[model samples]
Target chain A: MKIAVLSGKGGTGKTLLSVNMAVIGENTTYIDCDVEEPNGHLFLKPKEVIKEKVAVKIPVVDMGLCNGCQKCVEFCKFNALAYINNKLMVFDNICHSCGGCVLVCPEKALTEKDKIIGEVQKGVSQGINVLSGILNIGEASGIPIIDKLLGEEPKNSQKTIIDCPPGSACIVMESIKDADYCVLIAEPTVFGVHNLSMVYELVKLFNKPHSVILNKCLDGKNPAEEFCIENNIKILDKIPFDSELGTLNSNALIAARESPKYKKMFSEIFKKIIEEAQHEAAVNP
Target chain B: MKIAIPVNDKSLENGVCQSFGRAPYFLIHDIESKENTFLNNSAALSRGGAGVKAAQMIADNEVDALLTPRCGDNAAGILKVAKIKLYKTEGDSIEDNIKAFNEGKLSPLMDIHPGLHDHGGR
Candidate 1:
């Protein structure tokens, strides 16, 4: 079963929760889909990393084919192609990798070329297979890297934990596309409730079974908790706002592996998720 | 010499459009003929690369120079290749900018900003 951990914004403990749960779960494969800025490797600290470059197919023009037809330029909705001074000019960043230009070329002047945008690293950490996607700076989109990260993973009996990027954008949707269950990590503040609602709406729109895990719980009123209760969303677990957990996380250490307390905490959350997932399958399937 | 200026309205009485790529209309004024013509900017509604498309439109008109408040790097690159000089507008008035251009008062627009791409999604 693939369990996706995501939030509306950063600093909501997505990496912390996913890394902890992956450490406690048996036969777990942790895949970090946050290509823009992946930090799961810092905590997991995988060994013998194997890096593979990820690329997207972009159109390259061969001006020697002799036709100055503006067909490719007019066909491109992104306006990535332009004909100026009896020559065709292509903008790399503006191109969306749509092969229409190549397909529409009557003279076959346009052909697809690989443009490396990012890399994917695969390694092992404490018996768990850890994979991270790292996008190059200044790249427009990280969807290609996420596609490589999740697309190549084998579908097996192992419990896959997908750590998604922040927000309810296309990247987050791509990360959770194959998830059996989504774990929404939310803080306790009012702003946290707003962010939670965004992912809440996104998961609901995707028709995926999901639950909320409240992070940084304190003594006072928790707005996120209230929002979940009103929405009838399942409350998986609540992690207290403690300095011990913060220190471990800041030190780039997996709290579940270092402390027995965090291990038990994440273990319980993992168990509850398994049970909920099983119930969802039984009911839906 | 012909000059292209992004404008808000078809008339010359209005101010220059603050945005070049998304401007509704472009007023092409010819100094040799002492004539003015307004052409609708088709690149105004482009999903992306509006600046490049707008620059291509201006270049296609055979304009010698572009007078605007600002320009994007992608548009500037296209204009540079097209041999179109970019003169920074002193103010919003189209007539005033045209007069300044005739009098050679406007300076070259050196500060070209990076285009705003994918802002619609954010």
Candidate 2:
């Protein structure tokens, strides 16, 4: 079964939950889908076995054989082309490399070129295989890198745990789209509940079964729990606010190793996810 | 003969320079023709980073010059490659800024702020 852990806001322990869950699953493959700022390797400490450069198609304009009729500029839907003094200007960033500009160019001045935007790293940590894609620091769009990472998924694996980036943006949706089930990690604060609702809506749009995991559940009362109850969503588990867990997390230490108290907690969460996936399968069958 | 000034509405009006939440409007004006095109910055305003996307817009738009208070290093390098001139805007008003640019009154920015990443080699 493939399980994805996602949150709407950053610093909500999405990586923490993902890493711990992978550790507890034993023999699971961990796919870090957060291509922008992949922090999973810091915790997993994987031995990178292979690294591949990821490239995007950009436009390359030749000035020599050009009529510069501005047809390429007119054909570009992204506004990635311009004509100046009978010269064709190609904007590499805005060029979606759709080849529309090239096709419409009267002089055949436009051609496609490869621009390195990011890299994909495949490694192994303990018993689990790890794969992560890192977007080059200045690259704005991460969807292409995410697509490359998903394409590199190992063919044979007992269970795959996907670590999705924060928010309900296109990148996050793409990462969690094919998951058997999704684990929405949220805190009990108002902000957490609000973002959780946003992610829940995204999951609902995909028609995927999802459950909430309230990390750092507030003492005495849980606002997320109430929200979940009102919305008729099941609360998977509640991990109490633990100071030591927070400290270890900051220092890039695995929670299951640093705090023995949380090993059973993660194991319990893993078992529940498996049970839920099975239940989903049974219902569908 | 037109210069493009990429700025958020707040920076164009208040003169309060902020690192984030800049508007996505280009103040384009022809120096000789006196024609103006306030083109909306379709890419940079919507996207977060001020790197490849910004550079591409300037290059592809055939913008002769850029007028802004500051720029990240990656953006500067990309613009340099695209042969777009970078200048720092002095006045607060969009009209005054364009006038200054047309009269060759604005100063070229000497220092490029090191963005989250430096593209020195490329």
Candidate 3:
């Protein structure tokens, strides 16, 4: 089963939970979908097995074309093209590669050229296959790289864990679209609960089975417990607000590895997820 | 000529909108005629960091000038290519700033502050 770990806000222990889960569930394929700031590899320490450049098609105007009509500029929906002194200027950054300008250019001055926006890394860590995409600095779009990473999916059926980016936006949706189950990691805070509801709504819209992993659960009464109970969402696990875990995470170390105490916790969480997925399959079958 | 003033909101008293930061609408108004048209910047409001897109809108609309509180270097460079004059908003009032702009009270702000270099002022 493919499982996607998502959160609406950053720093809610999404990556930590995902990496530990992958380690516990050996032979699993872990995909780090946080292309903007992918930090999964920092903790997982996957050896560089494969690296591929991700490219996007951008329009390149040929000045040699006889006529310099502003039609190409006018037809560009992204405003990537402009006419200066009867010459067409193509802005690579703004181009969405829709080919609308090329279609409208009667003189055939516009042509598409590939531009490298980012790269995807595929590697193995502790027997778990890890794939992550890193968008180049100053690059505006991360969706393209995420798409390229998704395209690297193996044909064989195996348990896959996708560490999705923050927010329930298009990029996150794209990454988690085909997942069999989704695990939303949230903190027990006002902001966390608020954004959790947003992600919950998105998962519901997709009609995917989901559960919550409450990271940094306060020692006192947990507010999210009541909300989760009301919504009929199961609390898979509660990672306590431990300062040791925080320190280990900051030091680029997985908590489960540094402290044997947390291994059982992550193992239990993984077991519960598998059981839940099994139950779902049984009910559907 | 109708000039587009990027604003923080639809209301006239609201602060001028910066291309690099969070803001709502781009108030397009005529300098000589004093007529106003507020084009809701849906892209900027929803997607974040749509300064380049907004500048393209200004160019497509054939705006005379873009009055903003602050702008990033990339957006400023794009506007310059479209031949859109970039003017810094001096006062808070929309009318007052437009009047100041028309009367040549405001000068072209060269060397934008380094803080306004990127989206979210990073």
Candidate 4:
């Protein structure tokens, strides 16, 4: 079963929950799709076994093929090409690697060159395999790195958990697209509720069956519970704000609060996710 | 020599458009012919990088100078590369700015403001 953990707003503990699940779950492949900043390794402390660079194809102008039709400039949908003073300039950082520019050049002056944007790191820790993508700074797109991580032929595990980037933009959507189910982490505040609904709308748009997990909760009624009740979404679990857990959280360690309590908690949550996926599979099949 | 000015309307009697990228119309004035031809600023409707597209459009027109209140850094870089001189309006009226341009009374523009484009998603 493939599961994606995503949140609309940052600092809501998406990584925390993802790493915790990775520790407690067995035969799991943990893929951190948060290429912009993947911190899951901090918690899982996976021993690096494989490392590989990922690149995207960006257009390179030959400057010699001898025609200046400006067709390549017009064909670039991302506006990565600039023609100034009879010279072709490329701001390749923004290039989406569509290859349309090369195809449109009448004189075949434009060619594609591989540019390293990011890299995918693979490791193993505590029986769980970890794969994370690291994006180069100042780069506009991390989707290429995430794409490679997802598309790579991998050691198939019984369960796959994707740690998605924050926000409901293309990055988050692309990360969560292939998941069998999504676990949305939400806090319980006015802003949290607003962002929750926003990400919930995204999940609904993707038609992904999902459950909400409340993070850093106090004891009583909260907006997340209320919204879930009204929306008929299930509350898989809640992790109360404990000072000890906060210490562990800061150290990038998961579910060390009372060992057994948190371990049992994550195990149960992982089981619930599988059960939902199974139910959905039965219904669709 | 030619000069490009962002105008609110196609007519030379109109006022200058406050926006550079989203300007409604542009007047390309030929210094020798003393003729003014108007081109619709299609960059106004660009989904992204309107300033850069507008700069490209201006460069394509083969104008020697650009007259506007402001230009974004990205567009200004393009204009600079194309060797297009940047200038500011002496007054709001297109007629007055043209007169100022002829007398060289308009000041050169250096700094630019943020371009108007919706950040599609955060």
Q: TM-score of chain A, model 4?
A: 0.94
| Per-residue alpha-carbon lDDT of candidate 3 for residues B1-122, written as tens digits (9 for 90 to 100) | 87777787777887676553335677888767777888876447433235555655677778878777777655666678878888778866778888898788987767664332123343
TM accuracy, model 1: 0.92
Task: List candidate 1 stretches off by more than 4 Å.
Answer: A154-157, B9-14, B32-35, B118-122
Candidate 2 vs candidate 3: which has greater TM-score? 3
What count of clashes does model 2 give?
Answer: 1
List residue ranges in candidate 4 displaced over 4 A: A219-221, B5-39, B67-74, B87-122
lDDT of 1 by residue, A1-285 (tens): 899999998999999999998888877899999998899999999999999999998888888993987999889998888888888898888787878999999999989899999899999998888999998876668999998999767565378899999999989999999899999999998888898999999999999999999999999999999999998999988999999999999999999989898888988988998899879978987
Q: What clash pairs does model 3 have?
A: none
Task: List each candidate's DockQ score.
Answer: 0.53, 0.14, 0.22, 0.29
Best-first order by DockQ: 1, 4, 3, 2
Q: Which is better, 3 or 4, measured by lDDT? A: 4
Q: Per-residue lDDT for B1-122 in model 1, tens only?
A: 89999999999988899989889999999998979999999999988889989998999999999999889888888899999999999888999999999998999999998778745322
Score candidate 2 by TM-score against the native.
0.77
* Residue A244 lDDT, candidate 4, scale 0-100: 77
Candidate 2 deviant stretches above 4 angstroms: A75-78, A94-99, A103-107, A258-260, B1-89, B93-122
Error of model 2, residue A226, in angstroms: 3.4
Tens digit of per-residue lDDT, candidate 2, span A72-176: 755665555656445565655445556787788777777788899889999999888899989876554678888888778787877888999989988898898
Tell me the tens digit of each residue's lDDT in model 4 across A135-181: 98756688889889888626568788899999998898889888898
In terms of DockQ, the best-performing candidate is 1
> What lDDT does model 1 reach?
0.90
